[model samples]
Each structure stands twice: as C-alpha cells, then as structure tokens.
Target: MTGVPLLDPEIPLPPDFPNRMLTHMFASPIETDIAPSGTLLGLLQRGRGDGWLHALAAPRPDAVAALNHCVLRDPRPDWQLEHRSLYYARLYRELDAPLDAIGEHLFDPVDALEECEQRTGLALSVLGHLVTAGRQDALALLRRYAVTGANWRWALDELAVREDDAGLRELGPAILARFPGTEAGERALIEAVRDSFEPRPWHLWAEDPARSGQRERLARALEIGDFDRWQRQLRPPTPQPGWSVRAVLDWAREGYEQTPRQWREAAAARCLGAVAGPGDREVLLRAAVEGPSPVVRAAALRHLAERGDPAVFELIQRAAEEPDEELAQAAVTAYARMNDDGALRQARGWLERTDELGRTAAVMLARRGSAPDAPGVLAALRRVVRTRGTDAKELRALVEGSARLAIGPAVPVLRHIYRQTISSQLRGHTARALAVTDPTFASGFAVECLWDCEEETREVAAHHAATADARVLDRLRSLAADPAEQEGVQTAVRGRLAPS
Candidate 1:
C-alpha cells in the first residue's frame, strides 16, 4: 500500500522537501480571455487574481488544501516586502477552512528549530485578520497560541489589537511567567513593558494590587525610559551662530576624530556653508583636496559643488579618481547635485567610461538629463542591467529614468525586470515604468498585476488595467467595496469606473 502524503496531493508543497510525492506548481497560462482555475496545485503557486477566483470555485477539499499550503509555507518571494496574510485570511474565511493544518503547523515539534517570527508570522497574521472578521474559533486559537506557542509575543500583540480587555488581562500571568523571578528577569520584564506595542494590558496590570511588585517595577522602568530619551535629545554638539568658518571646520574635524558619522559630517558641511566668507574659498578649496580625513574632504567637496564653484568640477574628477571608494561615491553624489550646464557636459563625457564614475554619471543623467539624453540614458541602463542583472538595487534610478524619458525601447527590459526580480518594491517600480513606457500594459501585465502581492502594484493595475476582461472588472469592483483596501487604490478604482 502507498504511504499517505503528508499534505493533500492537490496542494503545492514547498520546494525544500524532497518527497517523491511532491508536485511542483507553475502559474496559469495568460490568454486574451480570462481562464477559469484548472489545477488546484497551480492555483496555489501563481497567487494571481485568477488564483483567488480558482481556489474559491474548486472542490472544497482542493480549495482547503491549497489555502493551507499557502498560509503554512508562505509562497511569496519576500514575506517582509509582499503582503499575503490578508489575501490568505480572506480565502480562509470564504472557504470556512478548518484550522487543523494551521494548528498542526503552529504547534509542530519542528518549531524548536524555527522559533522566529518569519516561520509563523503569516499564519498568525491570517488568524489575526480572521478574528477581526468575527470568527470566534479563530479568536480562541489565537488565545491558545498566545499563551503557549514559541512565537507567543506575535500572537499576544495580535490579540491586544482585537481581543477584549478581560481576554488580555487573563494572559498576564502566562506572559509574565516567561521572565524569571530573579533581578535579571525583572530587568527583562521592565524592557518588555517599555517596548510593548499595545500598552493597555500593561497599564491595567500596573494598577492591580495583586501584582504590586511587578507594577512598581514597570512604573520605574517607564519613568527611566522617558528620562533616557530626554537626556539623549538634550546632549549634543549643536551648531552655534558665533562660530567662524574655520571654527566650524575645526569642530567638524574634532567630531570626525571622535565619532566619524556621515550625517555628522554632512551637518558640518552645512555649517561651513553658513559661515564661509569671500576670503574663505581658498581654505574650502584646500580642504576638498588635501584634508586629512575623507569625511572632511567629502563635506568640503559637497559644499563647493552645491555653491556651484567653477574650479570644483576638476576637484570632483580628482576625488572620483582617488582609490578611496567612500570619497569617490561622495564626489559622484556632489557632481550629481550640480545644476550648471558644465555638469551636464561633463556627465555626457563620462558616460562612455565603463567605471563606477560612468554608472554614477548615467544615474545623474537619468535624473537630470533632457529629452535629447534619452538614447544615452537607455544605452547606459542596458549596460548596467546586463552587467549586474535585474537583482541590482542600483538600477532603480535608471528604471525610473526610463519612465521619466518615456523610452519606448526600454519597455522590454522593464518587463523582464518585473518578471525576474524577487523584490516587491522593484516590481512595483517596474509596473509604474511599464504604465508609461508600454502601450499594451493596460491589457497585459496590468491584468496579472491586480493579483500582485503589493498594494501599490494593485493601485497601478486599478489605474491602468483594461476593464474589457471580466476578471479585471470583478477584481476592481471587489477592491472598491472592501473597506480594507487602501484609500489610494479605492480612489483609483472609483475614478476608473466613474462614467466619462
């Protein structure tokens, strides 16, 4: 006899497992017309608008299996960046799916190895939303998990947001017991009290006579936390108006010697700009080239560039050629800030070089380049993506630049990045770029984008997706009606559906 599969066969198992029974899931094929959800396994993987529609319409067991697989494994490329909890929770409520799979996943023996929030955050969050939807069973499960689960704090926070006062008060002893009775435990308890997101339970506990010792400890900790914040704000190396340009420079040098923070160095540069007289240009010039600290040199270069000093262009070029990476990046940033025609001329000249400076020049041109600069910007973007691939965070500026220049040729590259990149934010950027660059976007990618995990992507879809497809209109109407949908998205949907 064959051994039973751990999960239902129709559910798409995570790729980490090597079981012979495991079946890989792929996205449903997109066509000119909207297609019905066919295989439950594929519905679970694609997680598009069609996935939700299919999962809801499939057989009860198949739909439940698909829902459980998604909630337990979290199929999104980046959980921190993309949203799946609410999506899964809505499906769970629609199916009235049993919580056995979720319960087993949460309380599994393997939780010892995977005790962090990442493993169970999606399930807990879905349960949290279910509680908000007036599911009493979901609320009870959350309470049980909050008291006994490995990631209890997350559960407790969720309950704090949704559960009644009496419910939260009952959890005090269990949560407090996690801290030991010793002095170290008391300190830990104080920290927990100070850092709590929902302070109502702590406040109620602080007033209870039965827990006087814990209350006093928490009260003192809260006072100390406030005092610490005040002390931090009051103590500083603030700039004074009486300081001369040389004095401010010396102050910057001293601070750099002590702490060497980039923000502090930038503040020092602003101070120099405020105090410098006509006669101080020579000193500023010298500091840009020969300052002992790179921070000082960078600050001076930034100030000089912002002031549009004519000689600073040659100095910026020298700094870019310097072996120091930090200084070179600073020079590039300073050069980008220059609004003069010379900066544009110099950027065009640097565009041909295949160095870090060349990449920086390309980004600057993308941001500030005129309509005439589109071809050069597109060429630079192609080279950068070809060299670094779609995963490079550095390409974001160029991606926006392609949109700003409205480069039609860059549409294919943007679409490729949209499909290949794992970053939700990057995908959102790609969607906005496509909205402007590609004429077919309203009917093609925009339709699939309605099911995109990011709300911003959904907003883009609402604004641009063609409503000729039945699925598009249904999703748009649902979004418009849902109170949970973002106001911006709702507005877009309303505007799109409004009679012209």
Candidate 2:
C-alpha cells in the first residue's frame, strides 16, 4: 500500500523548515476549543507535554514564535512568575519582527520604548568587559542599542553633526521635547519646523495634520536665531507669514550677502510684504539686480513696482534688460500692470527683441492693446506665428495671440503647428486658436491631433474641434475601430465628434 505524504501536495512546505515545524508543532486539534475557552487547559497541557517546551527550546530563529505560541495558547500564573522579564524581553524582540508576526503586545510604542531603554541600561554594564576583551563588534552592537527608541538623543546629536536632514526628520518632535535647549535639540526642532513647509500633495497634507503644528514650532525657533531649522521651513507652497518683518529683513539683509538662489527668493518674497522704509527699497533693489537667484530678482522687482514709486519704472526697465527670461518677464508684466506711457514704451522696445522675450512683452502689450500702438504689436505677433518654427513656445504665442487679436491669418499656422508640435499643451492651444480664428478652418488635422493627445489636451481639443469641424465625425468613426487607443481618449473624442 502507498503511504500518504506527511504534507498534502497542495499545501506546499514553507521555505524555512524551522519556522514551518514550529508552526506545525503547536497546531491545535480540530475540535480544540482552542478559541477563547481552551486557554486554561492549554496552559495546563503545556507542562504535561514535552512537545510544546521542546518547540520553545529549539535553537532557531523560529524559537521566538514557538515560545510565544506556548505562552499564548496556554498561559499560566507560575509560568509568568518564573519568566516574567525574560518573556517581556523576548516579546519586545518580536516588535521588530515582520509586520504580520508583530503581536498586539509589541505595538504599545510607549511601553516598547521604556523596555528597550531598560534593556540598554543593563547591556551597557557589560560593555566595559566586552571592550576589554577586544570585542569590536560588541561596541557597534551596543551603539545600535544606544541609538534605538527613547534613547535616540545621542543619534540625533550625531546626525546633526553630519548635517543629516532625513535622520533628524525621523527623530522628530519627541527628541525635540526631550533635549529642549541643547544645540542638537534646537537644531532638530528648527529642521522639523522648516521641513514642515515643504510642498506636499494635498492628500499628504491632510494625512500629516501635525505639519501645521510643526510649522508653528519652527516659527518659534526662528525667533531665537536657530537659523538652520528656521530656513528649512521656507520651502515651496509655504506662505511665509509675517512674524517679525524687521527680523526677517535683517536675516535677508545678512543672508543676501552669500545666499543661494532659493534662500534669496524666500527672503525677497517675505520682504515684499514687509512695509519697508526708503532705505529698505535700496536693499531690496540691490538684491533684485545683483542677487544670485532670478526668482529673487523677480520678487524684488514686484516689491518695488508695488511700492507706488514712479522710480520703480526705471528700476523695472533695467531689470527687463537682464539676461534671465523669468526676471525679464516679471519686469514686463509689472510694467504693464503700472500702465504708464513710459512703461508701454519700454514694453514695445523689448518686444522688438527675441521671440522668447517678445512673448512676455507681447502679452503685456496685448493687455494694453486699446492704446494707440496696440495694432502694430498685434500685426508683428501675426507675422511671428505665420513664419516661426513649430516649437511649443512659438505655438503658444501664436495660438494665444490669435485668440487675443481674432486675426484670420493665424488660422493656417495654428492648424499646421497643432499637427507638428508633440506637446499636448501646445496642441490643445492650437485647436482652441483655430476655433477662435475661424471655426471653419477645423479639419482632419484638428481631429488627428486630438486623437494623438492626452487627457486635458484631448478634452480641450475635442470640445473645440467637434464644435467647429463636422469632419471630425468621420475621424471619430475611424478612431472607433482602432483598438490601441485608451477608452477615455476614444470616449472623449466620440463625445466631441458626436452631433453638435
């Protein structure tokens, strides 16, 4: 007769035999009320049997699981009395076990930290002996323990020395509270606060509710000149509220001397809101002109323009000549907003330069197009669109300018550019431009580009193209038979290409 397999063929053996054996050895009987009711007898059964104790005593990594199973399946008062601390320590070790294996008892953060600290205290007593015995690895092991849990002060202090931002971030507020006024503690608090300002996803911001509190904490730290952490909080999307404008000004004034582009930008943005006296404008103006960051220069130009001084016009003129496109754009936009004749004259002069520079100058010029010179600038833009290559920037200028000018000449170029430019942003703009310039110019090119583009662009293109080009109907008919395209794109294309 053939013997049955010890394990069923369908139930494959675990890769680690010791863990599998430990698991199997403590497997309860089918009818064992091994549920809640079996606890008392399970404990009594443990002492009477060699199998449970032998499983616990096994010399393998799975030994921990077997021991826990023995204690949990049947707990006894005498067993606790005999091995209270040992059992607690072993259970603590399982806290670091794989997540599925981590028991409920090991999850109490406060209790785990306390026990870990106590174990560390006792372990340190033997460290001297180990050192004397030349156990180099022993020191490293002790160092690891010293850095774990509630006793993480030393690690934070060490991390601060190495300028480890992520490490200091992990140590977080608990270490901040523990170390208080110490330099490392101060630095950690500052870093924690500053890190809070980093641009996070909206979902992430909601998830990290403590981030607002962390920001407040960082702000308080800045008052005392813990500059490192104070500045950390100034990253993107964080609106730097006016705490002490004078203090921030002082820092900006000091910082701009050697500040990186990002830091100068942050400070310049802050100073813009601060009500500066006459001399403050000079400081800010210097930063705008010679500051390391173009963004900072842009902010400074904005600050000066908003100051209501006619002098800001000449300052902006100088900035508009700067090589940095973003700063020049800011200057042009600012000058347009002022709407003075001098500002318009400067904008027109700048428009005569490169297309990249001309784009911003044209936008400002378009806004002021009701002025006497507006028609000439519009004509120049019409020329640029018809003649320029199919780059995204030129396409955008063409499409946007055509919509603004409502010029018929832009129709062909916009259509051609839409077909050639790979950028979905430009493609969508081209469709809209064609619709705006002359809705009848909509054709197979519009439908083809819409099909070729992605979500937002496809939606925009379809909306304009279908409304204008009835021929998009045949294109949709052909697109329907194609299997390779996404359903969302096809559905949107169909919806736009549908009647009306």
The top-ranked prediction according to TM-score is 1
lDDT of each: 0.75, 0.46
Task: Put down candidate 2 lDDT per residue, 1-500, tens digits, no spaces.
Answer: 01111222322222443342233234421111221111222222222111222333445455445434433333222221222222222222323222222223222354343533332222232232333334454344434433444434332332333323443344444443443676787776545444432312112322334567554554565554446545556756543435543444444444445535234444455455665677676677776677655665666667666655567766776777888676777776665555566565666777766644456566666655544544555555555544444443544654666666676655555554553332445655666666777665344334434433234444454555544445456556655654534576578767755676
RMSD values for the candidates in order, in angstroms, are: 8.7, 25.5
Q: Model 2 scores what on Cα lDDT?
A: 0.46
lDDT of 1 by residue, 263-358 (tens): 345777788788887798999999999987777788889989888888988999899999988888888888877878778778898988787778
Error of 1 at 119 (Å): 5.4
lDDT of 2 at 344: 56
Give the backbone clash total of model 1: 0
User: Clashing residue pairs in candidate 1, if any?
Assistant: none
Candidate 2's displacement at residue 342, Å, is 7.9
How far residue 116's Cα lies from its native spot in candidate 2, in Å, is: 39
Q: Report the lDDT of model 1 for residue 487.
A: 86
- What's the lDDT for candidate 1? 0.75
